[model samples]
Target: MNDSAPSPTDLLSVGDVSRRTGVSVSALHFYEREGLISATRTSGGQRRYARHVIRRVSVIQVAKRMGISLSEVADVFADLPPDRMPGKTDWRRISERWRGRLEARRQEIERMENELVECIGCGCVSLRSCRVLNPDDELGADGAGPRLLPEIPTD
Candidate 1:
């Protein structure tokens, strides 16, 4: 046996985890700070992550690509068994939980598409007459700056 070789069960250094997962070291730190993933500290105070954290990082990447917020990912992770890698069943549950939010995003996109065509075809740049912008002058009641626009999704 090669004594120097790391075993599958060995805890990984932050750089090792970053290299293996293709997530930046700073991002790994951010994930830790956000309570998404956790690590143990060495006697020298270096971060050491369990091998299963690779799977957790993968899940974070996938969730980010799907426009899921980190808070939402954290919520899902809170329900997960921390000792093991997330499996097919875990992914299924996560995706199921996100389905409604994704569906709402899809509907929002469709609405934007339909309204975009109308806005362009009408050639009426007036905010008061813009259904896509003012939406029946609903913002008038709010009395605020740039209230003619919908809230842009950040995640």
Candidate 2:
């Protein structure tokens, strides 16, 4: 680390944010336009951001990994104000709101695994009685995907 480089505790310039986040400067500008993040502007119109903003956008990236939409994440952010970065308590609160959703998705995956196992076990290769079947018809009719594909798990 260069002695002249801003400390992690110091506010990061737009270039620093880009370097640390591996997000290009242009994209960061786009994020600002999309209202996903904001930065303070210097008198010369340069942008400066709290180092915590890097963490915020990192969190957003991970959420997107789970198939969350940007608007949905914006809605999540809407629940809390930006003046205070989320501390552990705020994190737990936010996570609690998502816990049910996470659980539902987890259960869906587990059920699908069970269905495939059952299909193999029954010797009939039918998913109708698979323990994983959602009673609400979540799987829909047989036309969905390869109905009985027991491909080698992707490890």
User: Which predicted model would earn the best lDDT?
Assistant: 1
Write down the TM-score for model 1: 0.78
Q: Per-residue lDDT for 1 in model 2?
A: 95
Q: How far is 114's C-alpha from truth in model 2 (Å)?
A: 7.1
**Model 2: per-residue lDDT, tens digit, 1-155?**
97754454587788998998888899788877878788887788888886667877776776667776778667777776674466777667656766766788899888787666755646643444444444444555644665456778776
CA lDDT scores, all candidates in order:
0.87, 0.71
Estimate the TM-score of every prediction: 0.78, 0.58
lDDT of 1 by residue, 15-119 (tens): 999999999999999999998888888799999898889999999999899999999999999999877788899989998989988999999999888877888
